[model samples]
Target chain A: MAQATLDIPANKIWGGGTSPFGASYGKLMMWFFLLSDAFSFSSLLVALGYARHVHADTWPLVENVFFHFPLTHAHLPLLYVGLMTFILIISSVTMVLAVDAGHTNNKKGVIFWLGLTVVGGLVFLGSQAWEWYTFIVGGEGVVKSIIVDGEVQKVLVQGANLQNNEYGHTLFANFFFFITGFHGFHVFSGVVINAIVLYQATQGVFERRGHYEMVEKAGLYWHFVDLVWVFVFTFFYLL
Target chain B: MNHVEDQSLHYSRPHSRTPEESKAVRKKILVVTGLLSLITVVEILIGVYFSKTHVGEGTWTLIKWFYIILTLVKAGYIVLVFMHLGDENKSLRTTVLLPMVLVIYLIFIALFEGEVLIQYVQEFMK
Candidate 1:
């Protein structure tokens, strides 16, 4: 009986010597990594929600706080972040095209689409840097009463920091810096990874390997970055 | 040169497609992108214009719910299509989505606890 069982082919979906989920090891692991990352971001956003609810009365209106745009004196009211969202979404499309081209073994298509994706990521990082700059510099300072040296004094506070902000509550800037800054770091890392993969593609690395799986893996990471940004954009800016 | 072509090692889809198939894939990408863009535009319009106009009203809360739902729709598309989870085996899909339930549970717990804490604080201050 033991010999018979050993001789039988384990051809079931969960059988040995085959992937259970029809995905390669690397891709499945990437998905799990993204899931864990999702947990991290969800925790942050949920905390933000809780804090926003707790401070409902004094919470600053996000639009009123983020009104400025790059090189524009006019108040744009979500236009700049909206542009960022489009850039991210477009880059995500390009990433999917890259993966599709990889599936077809089209080296040129992979390089082109991946190149555009890298450019999109760089542009987004630059845009985020500008936004951080605007936020740190802030607008005309807000005057608030503070106790300095045991006496109440009217002090003008400008910009945002860990301690205080011209915005209504300190937690507002705290969450803003933490969440967006974390997302920006992810974007920066994605760009770096994409640039490296693009360089490898130019060197015909995947072509010689007989498959462009690396590009697809990189594309997975890239699209995940875009996916996280979708939630971040909604929670941080829109809602 | 050696080529790796094992179904177990490679992805689920074949490594090449016909021109028509590739075109269809590209078309799907374009369609999804357009849908995502449209939803974002609608969200911004509501967030910017209607939010300002509806301040402190039931409609504002309703609009927020609308935005959240639309955001979820966009997120689903990105994960399902762009990341190609929709193309994966059913087992893979379940594996990925099942854990997300915990996240939803956490959100509700946090929101509910926050409400209770704020109520207790208000009563204490009074």
Candidate 2:
């Protein structure tokens, strides 16, 4: 430890007053904040796994539950969700492009890429809304056992709600809503943030500051949102 | 310290890359994009097809683990390449990634307790 400390130059020493991470304060804070956010998302997914495990016998097969496609009569399992995944991935690419353009101080490039990214985000959010609608409305009604007049009787149930689900188990719908709702909210906020950043870029905020760090920061967030969705898609739909 | 007046530091200048470097960056971005897309396609195909057609429970379990591993690969690329965490200093990278290790613990405990609880419910509550 003494030799290592002595090998460092005076200016390089992190004596409680320097950016030891070689990053701007804002960027470092953004990373830490994202780390914390990752924990929150992890816990939520963990809870979903726990609940699914406890009710493993009754848990619905996810592919069967999410097979519907827009403007189609045929049953297509995992098609719509797959499309949504592609949409988010494409947006993440555009976001990284925007950050790359920012690195080169290319304002027009940043605007173009950022604009595309915003559109991609909106499209993904719209797709998610459609998915949620299909989920809440469900498909064909199924007969389920329910207590009626102090006796258990088979009754036809439709769709999904907090109380019950036409799907295999109620927890299935609950977890779907909670996990995807949380992720959807993140995408919504990411879009809003990207739009604001786009406006700021147009108004020459980052250009005047002589750096596009804000875009890079927002790009980090957008990528994090996409990252979370990757897990959600696997655990919720694919698994 | 006159840090504000010193233009020699060039602290406010935007990063400039050579033409070759720019080309490399663009190529890397495109490659990562293609890789991510391909992995997603493979995942979808496996989920949609193999989940229905896979022969046995062992094979199905293998496919599930494959799905998880592929998802992690995709995630690593996003964080490391797209998010540029790969370019950050080692200290910063460690600071960000170390805490995520706890998530493995969380997953293990939750699933274990779930199995135990379900068994308990079967034995007692039922």
Candidate 3:
């Protein structure tokens, strides 16, 4: 039998009883890892909230700042963010399906869903890039114009927008790029991990072992990605 | 919930957890999704209302507090139910949640420090 551990009954924790779920060492360690990773993310977001609090009175409207359409003259609020959120939610669903398929030894099902998840992840990253580009390039600003006679001419320099002003001449933008960039890297890495698992599934690797510990581990990671997005959605977009 | 009901069964192909199990899990997912959408709608409403009415500080404060609480609730649900932490051992569960308590403390202190620092800087620039 493949160590089918369940929860440690509630009453037994204080009374020196061995935890039922304690039988699975990998699972317990995964829980610890998730806790630490969650903290690092929370630290970054908390700093963001602190900074936002100090500057809220002058903070540019978030939607207005983030809404410029890529390579177009139109702007719409909550457009890209809604798309990003939808992508993440969809990817989470696909990942759950992959986990389910892995447990069933359904190689084709696992590959299909895992592939879809990778695609979803790539799309989300692309959207984030577009959002970042707009902030960096099309950012709002007014510049002094030099006119000949009746015409006005000037080079527009993005002014004191949130991306340009706060964080010591836009440390906000710097940190935004750095933190979210790091997170996106995690997503990219997760996609690779999923690909490897898909390949293993195709080879019928886990069938011999009779347990899907690999799937459980990957599920922990994929769920963490989804979990991080919830906070990112709240702090970065919703607020 | 019994021995037979919870017994590990080898399954292949489409991966439907027995039909009854499927219904149970689907029900759980749907309920969580419903709560999530409700929270999102509430967020949109609060943002709109604040922009329009310039409501009382008491009301505004309450809304802010509400937003924070709901944010925590949504985060908790995703972790517990979807992440399967709800099925874990007690010690393991605490290991995941206890550090979160410290994060709350850090956020409070950061807010205070940020306010005081901003005030001092403004005075200095004067």
Candidate 4:
């Protein structure tokens, strides 16, 4: 009897008479998908770390690079990022609550938590926008420069580092914008999708079916977004 | 009752797991969340204040590893607590997480490669 039950055999949907494994087939695949995404993000971050190491002298100091109004007249370190981090963490919390509500069949709780999660996501995106604004519109304005013979030259030339100006390379800003912007895009998309799910859920979409895989899947995506932020925070902001 | 009856009863999905003891799980998750936030702040503080202070030579190297470890700790917590990977069955977790272990090993090798090359570059800085 135990063998028969454990045999969950191949899921008949696949014509195998069982799911090929335990647990929801779709969710298992989502986990696999996330694993691949994690690798891709890690590769990008590792490259950033390598570049930072190779350009140590020319890399813009991040603490001094990022801005937050209350801290610095011009460039403050880590304050905006800290806020963003908190917002993301809070969003993750709300997402968990949403999942909990889904599990417990609480439609109202699901909507509320999902709504809060989306709001937190928006806040994080707003923080990213401010961060990007500071980057694009630098204190001295965008210094189009290039590295010349080991010294940073302040002229818009080909193959030169824009991250560091006469102060540092300009390539630093390029990477910073590209990497963070990409992650911000992920957060933005996640928020949109989450809102859609929440909206559908509020309309009693998944509740009648007596299942909550949508919430679980959305939670998976949210966790991935948060996970990527950890790498970004460690390599880009902290390092 | 023979083994078959016992086995049948044990294998069946409990008619009742549905009323999610959400209250307990909620409390557990909140505690985990608070701990996660605190650790992140502490890690950042260490990076901010200690990195600038002039300690003995090689402190930067030590601190670099320290920061990385702390970040790893954060990652572990997020995976285990927030992602529900912790309570998952060990076999499933291993199947899913094995890739991550391999990636970290590769990252370790990559770090050494970059570090060695950077040291060579820094030698010419003076």
Q: Candidate 1: which pairs clash?
A: none
Ranking by DockQ: 1, 2, 3, 4
RMSD values, in order shown = 2.8, 2.9, 7.8, 6.6
Query: Evaluated on chain B only, what is the TM-score of candidate 3?
Result: 0.75
* Winner by lDDT between candidate 4 and candidate 3: 4
lDDT of 4 at B1: 45
Off by over 4 Å in 3: A1-23, A69-73, A143-156, A159-169, B1-17, B41-60, B122-126
**Is 2 or 3 the stronger prediction by lDDT?**
2
Candidate 2: tens digits of C-alpha lDDT, residues B1-126? 654432212322467888999999999999999999999999988877786445588898898899999999999999999998899778889999999999999999998899889889989965
Cα TM-score per model:
0.93, 0.93, 0.78, 0.81
Pairs that clash in candidate 2: none
DockQ of every candidate structure: 0.64, 0.62, 0.31, 0.28
Native contacts present in each candidate (fraction): 0.71, 0.80, 0.37, 0.29
Candidate 3 chain A least-lDDT 10 residues? A160-169
Candidate 3 lDDT tens digits, B5-53: 2112221122436778867765777787678667766765566446413
Instruction: Indicate the worst ten consecutive residues by lDDT in candidate 2 chain B.
Output: B3-12
Tell me the tens digit of each residue's lDDT in model 4 across A1-239: 36334443233233443343345656677789888888878887877777776677767666666645544585445756876888898899899888777766678888999999999999888888876665555555444544689986776432223434332565576677678878888898899989999889988977665666678778888988998898798888887
Q: Write the per-residue lDDT of candidate 1 for residues A192-212, one digit (tens) a residue.
A: 999999999999987777777
Higher-TM-score candidate of 1 and 4? 1
